[model samples]
Structure formats: structure tokens, C-alpha cells
Target chain A: MAVNDMTKLTLGPIAYHWSADTRRDFYARIADEAPVDEVYLGEVICSKRAPFHEADLPETIDRLERAGKTVILSTLAEVMLKRERKATEDLAAMETPEIEINNAAGLFARGKRPHRIGPFMNAYNEATIRWMAGQGATHICLPGELPADAIAVAAKAARELGLGVEVQVFGRASLAVSARCYHARAHDRTKDNCQFVCEADADGMPLRTTDNSPILRVNGIQTQSESYVALLPETGELIANNISHLRLMPQAVDMVAVATVFRDVLDRARAVDDADAMLRSVCRTTPFSNGFYHGKAGYRRIAMASPA
Target chain B: MSLAELICPAGTPAALRTAVDAGADAVYCGFQDATNARNFPGLNFTPDELAEAVVYAHAKDAKVLLALNTYPPAGKVDLWRQAADTGTRLGVDAFIVADMGVADYIARTHPQVRLHLSVQAAASSPEAIRYYCESFGVKRVVLPRILTIPEIRQIRREIPCEIETFIFGNHGLMVEGRCSLTNYLTGQSTNMDGICSPASEVDYARHDDGSMSSRLAGFTIDCFGADEMAGYPTICKGRYTAPHRPEAYYAFEEPVSLNLSRLLPQMIDAGIHAFKIEGRQRSKSYVRNVVSAFRAAVDDIRAGRTANIADLVALTEGQKQTQGAFETKKWR
Candidate 1:
């Protein structure tokens, strides 16, 4: 309630596998054109894709930082094997850019160092957020599954803790992360020999219900919503509350244009309805969903006349 | 001569007593509240009943582990704190916790109480497990059902805590303590509200062809053929259609219960300290039967004899069973 017009815009770590050139070009564009204030850089989904883009991390970080954007390196969402553990340690060992922790292992590796808590860390309540702050988390991105009321509650708690609260205002909502790769399994390929199958689906493989209803999306081990979470109608309430940072997850769309529309709505230069229409036109992604923000089914889109 | 302890589930006080009398080494349950994962209707013990159940289990030389595992809402952590406090007062053996806040509270409030990292924590790596052990003095961890025998063996050598594993029931493929598919449909999460495929929303209908269709909160989860046994309407078990596939298939996982009875000896050799059976919503007869059967198996393994595994086919959900990810990682 004491915050400004709205929160700063932040871009979450990309959860897909884009080609090396695509990753380079995407960050290049994000650094030069996007309206995001902070950009998270790293492989947060699968470790196999890290090497493909790992070589370009320095350039990407430099590009973003030189463009006056804060950079945070994110760790994998679920770390299990020795290789993944080493990857987390490597990220923690970095000196220039701070780390965003998605797995609990990052807490151990980044001992006492200031870090950001990614949405995958499950900071559902005040106690969890405060504990993360006590452990040196500078910012905490609450999961997309939280309703608007829960978001406001956590944002207030984060404000009290001096930790920024981030909400995922765009992109497909991640539902679950598993050890098995359904993307690879679908092709009768094992995870070890996945052969980079997930790269084929630039965004993510769409999974529909038996009636051809888009229900879930598979990106290797992570299962996400088949719909994109749109919060244009509720951004006012989010700003009226104490949300500190609004995160726009990178999807396979005209992301710069998408961010432009969101930035315009935040600046009041465009009405929410016009911005929503522009967003829908630019994002050739899935249907819109505001269910998680309203404490309803996550895949449905519901119109609200008044904010809670 | 105590091999791995046989841990069983008990939703009711009667079931708890039945498990203890049937020869369980330990029985785990939760209070009838959101603090536990099995927050089903007409299931779980009351706080007063838990006190009596703990006494009964202790009298029968069985341990009582209270599951206070669900993640509380942003401002409503009192429910979880109260559950932990009440369980501690009842003299439970260990508290199964998932949320970092709840674990921190338990570790600070009652440092003497044993804390077991619930599978809901999804701490699969050695570093994650070591973090819990170092931060909260967690004595044990219920390993998630996503690891293989070799992976478990390697993890055991690396972590400081004793490992408890699910040996039977709910071979759920979705990562435990992390799934929100149920919430995506019914607005109730297994991690927060502790209910999934909630009974209030589940409906079953018989088709004209004698097949059965199961729905959860008005969404069709799955349908079964005439001979195919129907399963609970969990989102993961339902068939889905994708653009790449022509017909609907089990995109997530099939309806199969985890039956690790055949792999008990290997698991014991793999250095598991406790073998857990999941099913807090089951009946006392089911608890008694399962406890008695697993008791004989663990006793046989202790005596250096091959355990005679029972055919629990009839008791399994969907009338199907699988070794799950414990034997291999390709159950899908």
C-alpha cells in the first residue's frame, strides 16, 4: 500500500531451450529494447541445455549490465545428480552477478551471500519469506499458483522484510517438475539420451485433455500450464498492494512488444483493455488465464469487476 | 537384529491401534487438519485421539510419527504450528515437515524433537538433504519416489540423515510435495490444503457400455473400460490428447500403486533405514492386513531368509501395481 504506482519490471530465467543464436539474440534484444529493469540469466530447467548457451552467458550478462539492467544468475529448479550439484556450486562461486535460488541446494552453496529466491523455491507464507530473507535473500518471486489475496499478503510480508516480492504476470504457469522427461518419453527416448528433443518445441510441447482441451505443457521434466497467465486487469490491485517487482517470463512470442504493452499499461499511457487487446494480438501463445490470481481453476479466464 | 523399520499409515485411531497390534514398528498419521497431506474428509486423527494413539503405540512398543507436512498459507501458519505443538505434547517420535518455516519453527521451539524431512520437500540431491540436516538437525528424510536403486545408494553415502522410503501405495509420478495439478482443477492444493481429488468433488458414472467414468470437480479425469478397474480421479492418471498424438494416452502416468515388496531385500541392502507404506485414507482392515504382511517380510529379511511377498493385487488401486521409479527411471 505504501509503494509507488507499480513495481519494477523483471524478466525471469528462461525455462526453455532456444538455440544458441536465439538465446544470444533474445538477451541482446532484451538488453537494448525491453522495459525490464532486472534480467535473470541461466539455465533453470535442464542442465543439458546449459552447455549450449553457457558459452554466451558472459556476453549476455555484460550486454544486460552495460544496458543498465541488474542481472541475476538462476540455478536449476530441481537439482539431483552430482553434475547438477556442481552446476549450482559453479553458479554460487560466481563473483560478479548474484544468484537466484530455485532449489534448496543453492541455499547451501550460496551460504551468507545475498541471493534472489525464484518462484520454484515455494515461499508460500510469511514465515518462509522471512526465513529466506534471514538467510540473505534480497528478493523473492512468489509462485504463480498464489491467488491475488495471497500475493498481496506475501507482498506485504516481503515489504516488511525488506525483500522485493515478484509476481509472474506472463508466460505459462509451471504446474510441476518431475525427474522423468515426458518430452523425451513421448518420443520413446530416455532422459540420458534425450538427444535434445525438447529443443524441437521452442516454447514447450502442448498437452491437451482427451477432448482436445489444452490442459498442460511439457518442457522436459517440468509440466506447465497450456495457457499463459495474463494479469492486465489486476495490475492495479497488485500495485495498490506492496508488490515490488513484476516478472515477465520469456515465451516464444514478440516479447519486446509484449513488454511494451505491459509497460504502457503500467504507465497509464494505454487503457488496460487496449493493452490487453494489444497483448493478445502480439502473443501468438496460448489462451489467457487469470484463474490462479482469483483462487479458481488455473486454466480458466474469469473477468472481475472489482479487485479483492 | 532390527533391520529396516516397517512404517505404516493410520488415518483413524482404530487404524493406528490396528497397525500397532498387527506388528508395525512405526505408524505415521496426521491430525484432521490442513497441516497434514492426507487431509481427506472423515480421515485423520483428532488431537486428543492422537494423544491416546501415541500412548497405545508406545505401549505396544511402536513409534508414532506425526505428519505436519502441508505448506500453510501466507498468514495462516498457526494451523501448522499448532499441529506441531500438539504432536510434540502427545510425545510423537518424529515430526514430518515440508515447509522451511515449519521446520525452522520445530527446530527452534522444540530442539529435542526429532525432525524428518517429508518427501514433500523434494530434496533429491545430497546438498539439499545435507542442508536440511545441517539447518534443522533433521534426523531422517522420506526420499521422494523419483530415484532409482543406484541413485538411492549413491545418495545414502553422501547425506548425513537416515533415509525413509515409500515401499507401497500411491506410485504418483508427479513430484511429491510440489504438484499443483489438483489445485489447478479444484482450487485445493495437496501442498497447501492437503487434499487432492477431494471427495467432495469426485463423481463416478456408469456408461452405457458398462464402462465407468471418473470426474473430479466436473472435469473428466479418466474413463475405464468394462474390465479395467477404475482409479481415483487424479489429474496425473487421466489420459490426454496432444497434437502429436492421435489418441488419448496416459501422458503423465498410469493408475498403478507402488508395490516394492519384491524389492525389500535390495532396498534394505541399499541402506534404507525405514520402509514406509502410504495410504492414510484407507480402512483399518487394510491397515491391519498391510502391517501384518510387511511385518513378516521385514522379519524374514532380518532372519537372513527370503521374504515371502504377498500378492496385494486386489488391494491395489486400479488393480495394478508397479515398482515405480525405484527400480528404474522409465516408468512412463
Candidate 2:
């Protein structure tokens, strides 16, 4: 498929922990094979894990850019440490490709250069979007939990302002982020000595209710929905609303195929049913949901009858 | 030295007067809508009640802070906007706002009314706080109960706004302003709906084996034995199972209230301008007791007294308390 015909797919920053080599190899392979248009790279989860992959970051970015994929650096979702702030400032200072501001630290650090605002920055209304656009944000990813109506309004506003708008199309919704690490605390370790045990769960540790019902997924300091969010059929609606980018969050499964499925659906190369089947085939998990878009329970499954 | 403002929660008109009579510097309450976090039935004030409460609070020299903190749903922002307008016209001292839209609206329309960033906004860091200040002209920020004194000091040094920290109350370990666990289970969020476990959906039943189960939306969140203190059915504080552990554990957080009376001097020195006590749904006696205690405690700290406060433990959630993420990040 021609790049112009393809729906822009951005690989959201890795929200889970992985070994440095694993992270490096994953991005390298994504640059080589993933059907993504752009890739956001950085430590949006925890600052402690950044140093492990810091050395390989530049080479990874180079590889992705060399693969004709746009690369954007992401700031931390919750910046607390001075070192974290310094790292964000460094990212902002670099005249690299575009930057995604996960928190306000990046916005402050960006100074005057145009940047992208990640969903964590909370641009709910048009005024907020306009304010962010004024602050040098060229692209803005609306928060994951915002319903379609709000997205429509923001997307309209973004269009009027000539800014790019992105939305999460797949992967578990990032529900919340905290200062405390439940992964470490679960293993009887403090935040200071977390032992980096979160790396053990590449996809996030599953949390179940007392009666053993799967309720949530714990990825380091962030909590995610247990049900995956898929929007293969909503491509037309999103496009109609002026959403320019479809964000595919990094998961443990076949993200490449996930990207391809979304790409085909967006390009009208495949029907929504075929894309849904292909997605199910590549998915290592169960049940897809798009309830947040419908303003219902986020876990509810909204089955689309057709690609239209 | 300025007396540390004692902001108290008043869920009802009676509670408002109780807090005011108990010497609260300010009483924060919410309308009986989805705009505030404590949207429990029989807890919040109606429009007339709020107007009366504002008059009552103003007469007693205690300010009224209207909490319009919930994130307005996509197409339903009118409710939040109307709430803000009502609060402004009703002579509210400030509008405690969490959602950016609400803040932006209040800043644009009611420029004179003070705006306090609700802890629900979860603007924990200095940069995040400054962004709010720079964008919306927020006068004060209610710091989330997750920062240590040193972190608070650092934030105070950077942000150009007055900082209010929770001194005694149910300290949430979960991320403020962004928690959706309750919404996931009960289809209502503290941020979006101003409720955690709405009373209408909560049910308590006894099992045959002498264990009691607390259910929210037909899903059992936690089960406690007869001897155990049955806590509220919040999904985060509920017991959960993991593959490694055979027994259930509090995956999100253990039930604990934040009591930082011991850290009064340090927090005050850290430039904490106001101290908030957090229980709006409690009894009048609770309001009177907790408010007077904290009011005296702030006075003692200001007067260079030892600042002894021990009776607060009984008012804590699950009858337990912690300094929480205030003293140190790792408080086990």
C-alpha cells in the first residue's frame, strides 16, 4: 500500500517494562516490519527503567527514521524526580523529530518548538486544545476515555486550528497512573528498591477480585483495563470527525498484524468483518470493546455489523 | 504568621453549620449533582440549600468553596457549566475545579471568583501545577495526597500558587483526577460522576459461613468476616487475587485514612498555605470533632507547641490510619 493511502498509525510509547535488549530489538523490528506510520519512543512509564535503554535509544530512533517512519520522543506521564525533569528537558532541547508531551514538563521544556500533546496531558475541550496548540503542540492525542461526541467537537476544533488529532484505536486503555508502584509493593519491596520486578510482566500483571474475577491490569505504576479496546469499524466515523491518527498502544501480542489490520480497514482494502477476524486471529486475548466511545461502561463490547 | 486555613467538608447544610461553628476557616460542599466527587444521595446540598449554606457560612466568617470537580461528560458539559455559574452567583468564595473545561469556563466568565485546583485534577508535580496556573489563572491547588513533604516543598518552590494539602482524611493511594476502577465496576467514576460506589448500587449481605460480602453493581468487591470491620465497597480498596498468591490481597490499596498531624510543622514550613480535613459524609459529631481537632492542631503548630494529635485514629477509614505518601514515598 502506498504511504499516502495508508491511515497514519502511531505506536504509542511502551507503557510496560521490558529488558533493554528486548525494547531495542522490538523497536528495530517495528522500524523494519511494523505497518506503523510513526513511533513514539521514551520512558512514559517509570524513569528508573529509562537508563537501561538510554544508550540504545538514538540508534533505535535512527533505525526507525531510516525505515521511513516518523519518530517522536515521549515525556514521562508523571514526572516527580529531578532526573526525570532533566531528561524531559534534554528531549525538548534536542532538535529531533517531533516530541509528544505526556506531562506538562515536556510542554515547559519545549519552550517555543512545536510538539505533540499525549493523552495524559488532558485536552478535554476546544479551549484546552487551542491553548495547547498555542503552546506549540502541532498534534494532540485526545484522552482515551473521552466519548466520540467530545472527540468530534475537539476534532472539529483541531481542524479549524489546523492541528493534528489522534485517538487510541487498540490495546488496553491506560486508566490511571500513580506515584506508588503496586508491582513492587506486591512483592514486599519499596519504591526506592522496586528491584525492577515489573519487567518480569512484559504485558502487565493481571488483578482479580476476591472471588477471582479479572478486574484490572497493573503495569508498574499505571493501571489498565483488562479488556482490549479495538476500533477497526469506527475508522469511518473517526475519519468523518477529522481524527487524523489512529494510535496503537504497544501490547505483548502481534502488533504488526494489528497495525496491518487497522491499515487495511482504513484503506478500504478489507471489510471491517475481515479486519475484525484478522485481528481476532492475531489477538492472544479475548473480547474487544469500544464502550468508552459510546459513553457506556468501558468494558462493554460494541460489535460493528459492517465496515461502513 | 497567618493562621493555616482549616478547610472542611460539609456534605449537608447541618454539616456546614457544624463545621463553621466548630471554627472551620472555610467549608467546602457540592451541589446534589454529578459535578462533585461526593455525589452520594442524602449527602450534598440542593440549589436552595447551597444558597442558604453560602449565606450561613459567609455570616459566620467562614468561606464556602463549591466543589464542581467532576469531569463533564462529552455532551453533558452544560450541567457542570451551570453548576459553576450557580456557584459563582451564589457568592461562593471559590470554585474547586478538576476538569480543565470547568476551570477554563470559570476563569473566562467569573474572573473575580477564586479558583482552587481540586486534588481530583491530580496535578502533583510543579510543572503540572504551573501549567494550570499559567493557563487558567488558578489561585490555589489542592495537592493530591501522594506527595512527600520534600516533594511538596519542591513543588511549592516552583509553582506560583498557594498549596493546600490534606491533613486528616481518607487518603487515596490511587491517582487523583484519573481513577476509573470504580467506573469500570459500577459505571460511575469519582471524576466523571462524582461518586465511587453510589449508595444505590451498594448492597451488603451475610453469607452462611459467617462472612459478610459488600457488593457494588451486583459484583462482590470484598468479603469480610463478622469480626472484621466492613469497609466501603470501593474497587481499589477491595481484596483481589493474583496468580502467585492463593489468598486475596488489597491490590490497589489497603483501607487507610491520611493523618499528617505529626508532619504539621514540616508541611507548614514547606509553604503549605492551607490544611484540609476530608470527610463530608460523616456525622455532625465527626465534623465537629475532626474540624476542631485540626483547627487546634494548626494553632498549636503555629504557636510552636508540640502539636500532639492522637484521637484522630478513631475517625480513620477501616479504623486505621497512615501518614500516607506524605512523610515518605514508602510508608509501609
Candidate 3:
């Protein structure tokens, strides 16, 4: 049951605007209990959420680092306002802990300094990954929409260039980001007068189709899938393709226990069926999906044949 | 201020002629493949047709900007590279590119050719625009539709390359080259496949309640009453129900087109170099009327005369239009 030694488990940035106390507690639990090797921190969806938690960043980073987990700060996925530009500049100027850039403005600000490419940045092909490597990208988390074959090709290209390749294996898939904040607009509020309404739905507001089918989630300006993307069974294929990391996006579930289950599966200590049952129990109401990896509709649940 | 060049869309060669003849300074088109953003079926140009289009456009002193804007999939860069080679050989005026790979290839292979950053690249900030201009020698950037007038003016002052903003047509507020909403439901995407809510997967069903539901791949996007006009269900403009709201709402945007007709003078004063129209899937009459109207308007503004705005609600989607975010940040 031994996996690739480089196949580390990573936690993506929190895409929601949780209260500063809640964020501190979440990071404290993750720092001490989770089996993940890396943790990404920042307010990636909205700039308005940064100020509420800025004073507590040093303690979170120190705790994660002290617990032997690598910490990476992420930039805003969309930078338009003057404050956002300044924030990207300030983060890009840092030289200590690494920065994961999600927007092109961060790329310009970093300017050949080594940084990680967040999943929000589109790295869909070998040519694009190679070009990013030329721009000093040391690691890249591929876009969530890319299919399996494309991931294999991109992973191979990245491996050949000595860059780390990571793929999201758990949690809600981020589908789209917009200039306007849908979470606010849905509540009859403009983005400017949102009043931090997104802080209500920590897991994101549920958006249902006309027939009342729960299909999508609205997280501030981002649109995400209702089902969590679980790829526990496909870890073998991902490792075979030379992927170096598996990312699990932070959600409201018991992430410490969730990370333990994934770690058990990765370590060959638990059977796939047992792990699947455990995950289902952990994520009670949400469904599991791997259709994006199977080259079908992302929300589809293509049943996989049992492994030999 | 100098009159800004009018850039128009041409899905077919006939539309190309119509645009140029209607007073478009330049016409943007794509091959009948995934290399361009508007890779719709039965639309776009073949190599032979593109050669003829270049000749016809050059004869009338109009420029032909070939759009190879979609991202090249892994292990399939040859298609985009070959398309670039074809466009270069066909004597196109410039290339509108979105992917960094395609931009790098074009910049390295054909240094003499001009490169314009497509809106699909989502280069909304001055720093992002500067990165493209410096890294790949991109000469012009079609700014995304999310910026306000003051933001555009500030960006124009900071960046070195020419600026192009959408003046009419699709008010796609989503950051281009990044949206995956359609792909989440249909397995196809605008960034990789050059289609959004593709027509092939779209269907309409009449319910027993005397209402029709517009769907993409069987997911109900919106239901229209008998008297209400049902717009095409592009994912962003679709209506959906949320938990806090009692009724379905346009979570992203309403069904309307962006018509910045009255802001021509202010746009010119903001140092915009080109004004772009965003409908490659539109008809020949649409091309003619919109192009001629904007042509006369640009002329009137440059000549210090008040431009007469025309009523173009019929040509817009849902028979309605708005000035969108360009007028104010409050539209969000």
C-alpha cells in the first residue's frame, strides 16, 4: 500500500468568509490534528474579508509551521480594486514563506520569483505549464475542470521540468468566479453594500435548479458544485501519472478526520470500501463525485469497477 | 481626441464583407475549429475562405484580425500552432490570443506579426496587461467587461499597449478564460472547447402548465411564461432558486446586452484606442446595422456633433439592453 513518497496531501485556502475566531480554531485544529503536509492560507474570494483576520495570520502560520506543515499564502483570484492591487503587491514582495498566485497581477508582481500557481490560475496544457515554468512557477495546481487524460499530459510535462504538480481530490469544486458577488446579489444587496452577508452560510449558500434540485453553491463571487469531488479510489492513477500532491479544499466538515481517512487510504492501512463508507458517514448530506476525472459532466457519479 | 477604430465580429466571410462595407475599420474572425472563442457549428471561415476574406478586406482598407484565442489542450498544441501558421500565411493583420502558450508560440515564431490579447485572457488590471505586453510583445489588449469607466481610465494611464473595450453585445461579466459553470454540467467549456452552453446540448421543452423550460444538457436553466420572452440559456444569465430567496432570480446577470452607445465621447477621452462589438454569432443584418450606427456615432463624436443614438433593442438578446458595469459599479 506504499504510495509515491512525493505524493503529499495539501489543504487549499478557505474560500468562505468565516469569523476570525472560527478561522483561528479551524487552523489550530488543522495544525495539530490533520495529517496533511501543507496548508494554504488567505482570503482568496473577496478582499473585504482580509481585514477581519489580518492580525491573526502570524499565529496561524507559526502554528502550522511548528507542526511540520508547509504554509503558503494565496492571492485573490480576481484583482480590480485599488486595495486589491496593493494587497497583491504586498504579498508578492514577501521573501519568506512561499506565495501561491491565483491571478495574473500576482504573476506580474512576482516577476520571475519562484511561486506556486493556484488552481484558480488556468494551467490546462503542457505549453502553458512550460511557459509558467519559464516564469519561475515551482508548483502548479491544475484547474478543476481538466479531464484525466489532460491531467496526465500536464503532469508528465511538469515532472519533466522538475516542477511539482498537484490536483484537488476532495471538497467542493470551484466552478466559476465573477466580477459581481452573487451571494450578495441573491440577498437583494449590491456588492458594495453586501454587509458581509456571505458570512452566514459558512459552507456557502445553496443554489437549486428550477425543479428544486440542489445543484450549485454560491460562495461570495465564486460558484461551486454541490457535491464534493472525492478521488480516493483514483489515487493510484494520479500517482501513476507522476502527480506530486493531492489537494483537499477546506470545507465545514470534520476536515481533521477527513484528512485521516485519506491518509489511511494512501498508507494502505484501510480498504477502499471501508474508506468510502467512512467518508460517506463524515460527509452525511453531501454526495461524492469524480466525473470530472472521468471526462464526463462534473456532477455525474460514474460508478467505478472494484480494484483488483 | 482621435477617433477610436471600430472593431466588429464576422462569423462568416459574408459577414466579413458586410462589416467592412458597413464601415468597420477591422473585423475579427476565427477558423471553424476550437482555436477561436466563437467555435460554433456552421460558422467561421475555412482556409480558402479566409484567404479570400483577407484579400477582400485589404482591398477596402479594412484589417483582418484572426482569433486563435482558445487554450490548446495538452498534447494537442499542433492544431493551434498550425492554425497560427495558416493565419500568418494567409496575410492576416494580427492575431487575437488568450492562452500563454499560443501567445508565446506566436511571439517566438512570428516576431513581425502583431498580437492582441483577447478578452478571454481576462487581463483586467494594469499589471496583468503589462505582463502580457512585456512577456509576449502583445500590442493591444481587449479588456474584460468588468471594469468601470474610471478603472479603465486609470488602467489606460498605467499600461503601455493600446486598449480595446466592448461597446456593444454580450455583457459577459464573468472573468473570461476562467469560468467553468457550463463545463460542470455539460462536460464542455468556453475556455477549452470555445463554446458556452453549446447549441448541440441545448433543448427546449413545453410543460403542461403552458410554460417552456430552456435547458442545457437536461438541467433546467429557466422557465418562461407564455407572454415572457425566453432568452437563450447561457449559464450566467440563467435564473435559479436560492434558499433565502422565495423566487428564482438571475444570480449572475439578467438577460440583456451591453450597449455603451452614449459613452462614446467619454471612452474616447479615456484614451481607448479601439471600440469592439461582441457578436460573432449574430446575423449579417445585425452586423450591418450595428456597425453603421457605431460608425456614424464615432464620426459624429469626432466632428464635435451630438451622436444620434439608434434604437437597437430588436437586435439585442431578450429585446433589452443596458449600459452594464461600464456606467457604474452599482450594477453588480
Candidate 4:
């Protein structure tokens, strides 16, 4: 496989809760300063929060586009409500930019509209990738939990099918999404009156086992691994697999610095040493891990220190 | 209306015959590989066993549905493709598929075989189901266990396929076909490996306080008192303490079986084409008892008599039962 200088960096849509201003400012700064190739902007979490930033989406999209970034409108992770369906349909109808479908509802609504298949769509193999490409998908983000061998196979298939492949490069991996909101249920409130308590933690709350070992993170309805999925050490394998893009999900702190480190690693490959030092400087919470890429237990940490 | 079909799970060849003799209208089983969700060792049939089981079911005037539900790991599509071919060659009635690639493979190559979208696919809406039907020629869809009766009725009016629902057995409140929490904890998933808390990783220890703790991969999933029965240690059914909750509670769902015997007539009236019993990991006696009870209830409902089905509650999870996402969403 040939590595291309056009290595794309995609800013995956925020998977955690943030206040309206915080979200607005994060994207505005991403638009102006971040060295990203594409920006996926929309509410991928609870539908109740969408209305908070719904009015500002157009301005954000415009600003990101004016800053020489390709903007892809994103859809919700799960679509069960009437308003959610309408929101996905409205996003599919937007003519300004392409859409990245996170669920089957979004894929159905797009219906051959030439969209990007988000990681949540479950395209793990060559056959599924070919099917999605045949359905007019131009880019396919492989599922976050898939092993590296699978990623290589999928990247090969994507190259043959003439589509782009993107992998999560940083941030807490989204483990699962559910219809029931544990946050609201924990607070003794129904899903209807959740009081938007998930916004208190800009990132999700750390979930530890009864033994007090950090194991997971709980957002509104989505559960994520506590270990931040860092793919910086596997840059060589990713390049060998013909992966065209790497996705970085938005976190609460030092996001621009995070993007800059990835940019340095992608640009100067071998010149960028000390993966641990880079991660320690940029990460605000949780230790960095790349075990998912090595096909080991995702929670296990692989030694990335260069041969001393 | 025609005779209501009773679909039962068969983990092995002996279980398949047991379910058939118990008067199951159809028996669903999986191959001994990752292609099926019930990928337990000592359970599920080999290719030769499945061929013989299908012949046995056909002789008994019953059908066999082969579960090829797992999403094929990348570079291993050949295994799933071969499983589809083997099922079709053995004359299985339908292929219950969860992956788009598997569905497409069966739809294109073995067009003669019937395709039933497994609940794992998580196609919850009319549009999503309709897309599968229009694209892949799916004949039936195993509806997810999270819909209300009214929701199922509304969906039936929209899609062009038969609907098979879980009438009794393990009821998963979480979205089917999308959960990997089990694999996260125990390194095996029902969707990928067909085993949730595989027997190798599970252990039961009696605590000093007379409570039994069931652990999976060194993590305590649940603990039950002396009188309370210890259910299987699945991630979803495990008790945990959240931030706001003071004590340990079921953060996801309580361990409860879904007994919709009381709602059979309502489901039938709502246009359900089949009623499914969900214990592939159970004993032969359980298969015989549950199938016979449901068979009698369906016949009684057809004969216009008051159907009674309360004795089966003892077999439910936690020794209690609930209508589960059927009556209303307020149970949450």
C-alpha cells in the first residue's frame, strides 16, 4: 500500500455533553486554529441537547468551511424519537455539505446521497464496506473497537473500492449507546425530565469497578472506555493499511494541542518520538492506550517507548 | 387465522429433537462457530448434526431456522459465507442474519433461502425494516424486545414482512445486535462470539454472609442472598452503584424473564405472525415444558377459550415475570 501525503485529519463529532457556549467556542476555535482536514459538527448525543446548539450549527458550519475545512453534518447515534427522525431527515436534506450517517435511520434517510458512514454504522468487513460503497458512501469510518488486523483488511478494501477509511486516533472510545439514560435513572428522574444533568461533567463521569479501578465512562446514554484510545504508536501500520484519515473526538481540554501532536506525528513520522510524553502533555484525564489497534484487550496498554 | 407457530431454541441435536417432540412449530439452532450468537462449547450443532436435525424437523412437520447472526470479523468473511452455504444445502427454512454482508450474501447467492433479520440488527423502525425488505428480500423480522405493543402494531402496519417476537425467555431491554459490554468485561460477546459470560470465565462463590457472588473474569457481576437464586452473570443484569444511587442497584435492568402469555391474544391481534421462546442454553425439560404450555395456550386462544399460563412463572428469571416493554415504557 502506498502512503499519501494527503493524510486527512477528521474532527469527530463531540460524543459528550457541553454547554452551548462551550460547544460553540470549541468549534469556533477548531475552525480557526486546528490543523484538521474535515470537521463533523452536530449533536451525536441526547436529542434534548440538540436544540441548545441547533441554532448555531449553520454559523459553525460556515466558519469551518471558510477556514478551508470540509464540513460534514452528523446525525444522532440512536434515533427513536419523532424529533430525532425529523432532525436526521433535515440533516440529510442539507445541500451545503455532505452528511456522515451514524445510524441506519440516517443511512435510510440519506438514500444514495453520497454520505460518509460513521463508525457506529458497523462496517467491519470487506463485504459490508463494498455494500456501503455501492450504496454511495464516499468515506467509511471503521468501528472504534475493531482490532488492527481488521482495520488493515478494511483499509485495503476501501482502497480497492475507491473510498476513504478513517480511524479514531484519540479520546475515550464510545463503548456502547443505549435507549435508556442511566444518568437520569441514577438521579431518580425519568427520561422525560432528565434536567440535563449530564452537562455538569463536560466529559462523561469516570465509572470504576466496586474495587475502585477505573474501567469505564458514562455519558448520558452512552458508555465509553476510561482509557483514551491513542493510535499514535500504530501510525506505521495505519499508513501501511492505506488509511487516508484519522479521527480525533473532541474532549474538554487541550484539544488544539492534541491535534498539533497528531499533526507532527503524521507529518514527520520518525521525527516524532516520545509518544508517552506527548500524551501526558495533552491528556487531561485517563491513561493513554493503543491495545485495540494491536488486537489485544482494549484496556491493556502497549509499550510504545522507542528502543533505548 | 392459521395455527400459531411456536418457535423454540435448540442448543444441540438432542435438544432439537426434544423441542420437536414437545410440539414446536419450528426449532432455531446455530452452528458450532462464531457465526451464531450462542457460540458455547458443548452447545450448538456441527454441520452434520444440523443436516440431520433439519431432516428430523421436516419429518415431524416442523421447520428449522439456522442462526447465522454474528457480524463476520474482517478477513474472515469466508467462515460466514460457508455457514450460509451449509445451512442452505441442509435445507434449513430460514437464515436469521444480523450483518448486512451476511444478509447480502444470502440474498444474492442463496436467493431461494428465506432471510429473517435477527433482533441483533436492531432495526427498530418501519423505515429501517422496510429498507431491509426492499433491498434483501427478507421474509420475517425478529422484533427487538424493547418495543411496546402499540409500537409493534404501528410497525406491522408499515413493513411488508412477518413479525416474530419473544413470548417467553431471557428478555434483553438493551438494544439488540449492538451491545458489546459483555465482551468488554469477559472478552466474549453474544454478537461476536455467541456467548455471554462463557462458562470458562464464570465462577460462583459462597460469601460469609450467606450470599452467593457470581463472578466473570475476576469481576463480581452479581451477588444474591441464600434464599434468592443466583442468575447468570451477564453485564447488563449485574448490580452496580451509580453516582446518585447510594446502594447497588440494577443500573441497566433487573434480572427478569419476559412472560407475555397474558399478552398472546393482544400480540396476535396486533398482527404478530409467530411467538418465540428464548432459552437455547436451557435443559430439555425446560424446552418440553415451555413449548407444551405455549402450544396449549395458542390453541386455547384459537378455540376462543380463556388462556391460562401462570405455572411457567417459576421458570422465569429471578423467579418472577413482567410483561417487559410490552405493556408500557413506565417500567423503566
DockQ of each model vs. true complex: 0.67, 0.51, 0.82, 0.51
- Per-residue alpha-carbon lDDT of model 2 for B106-219, expressed as tens digits? 899999999999988878678778878987899999988878888888888788999998998777877777776667656566666787767788898898888998888877
| Native contact fraction (fnat) of model 2 | 0.44
Per-residue CA lDDT of model 1 for A128-203, tens digit only, reads 8888898889888897788887788888999998888889989888898888888887877878889998898988
TM-score of chain B of each: 0.95, 0.95, 0.97, 0.95
- What lDDT tens digits, residue by residue, belong to model 2 across residues A1-308? 43335348889998888888888778878988888989998889899888888888889989999999999889888877788778877888888648888876677667668888898877777767776777777988988878788899988888789898999999989888888888887887877899898988888888877767677888888989888888888888898888999999998887888888888787777878877889998876656789888776778787755557
> How would you encode candidate 4's per-residue C-alpha lDDT over B54-86 as one tens digit per residue?
999999999999999988868989999999998
Of candidates 3 and 1, the better by TM-score:
3
Interface RMSD of 4: 1.9
Candidate 3 residue lDDT tens string, B192-291: 8898889888998888988989999888888899888777878888889987775988888888889888787899889899999989999999899999
Residue A199 local lDDT, model 2: 89
Q: Clash totals for all models, in order?
A: 0, 1, 0, 3
Q: What is the DockQ of candidate 4?
A: 0.51
Which pairs clash inside model 1?
none
With a 3 Å backbone cut-off (N, CA, C), the pairs that clash in candidate 4 are: B37-B194, B39-B194, B120-B177
**Candidate 2, after superposition: displacement of residue B115 in Å?**
1.8
Categorize the docking of model 4.
medium
The parts of candidate 1 lying over 4 Å away from their true place are A1-6, B205-212, B310-318
TM-scores of the candidates in the order shown: 0.96, 0.95, 0.98, 0.95
Worst 10 residues of 4 chain A by lDDT: A268-277
Write the candidate numbers in order of decreasing lDDT.
3, 1, 2, 4
Candidate 4 C-alpha error for residue B261, in Å: 2.0
- Candidate 2, pairs of clashing residues: B120-B177
Best by DockQ: 3
Question: Where's the lowest-lDDT run of ten residues in candidate 1 chain B?
Answer: B310-319
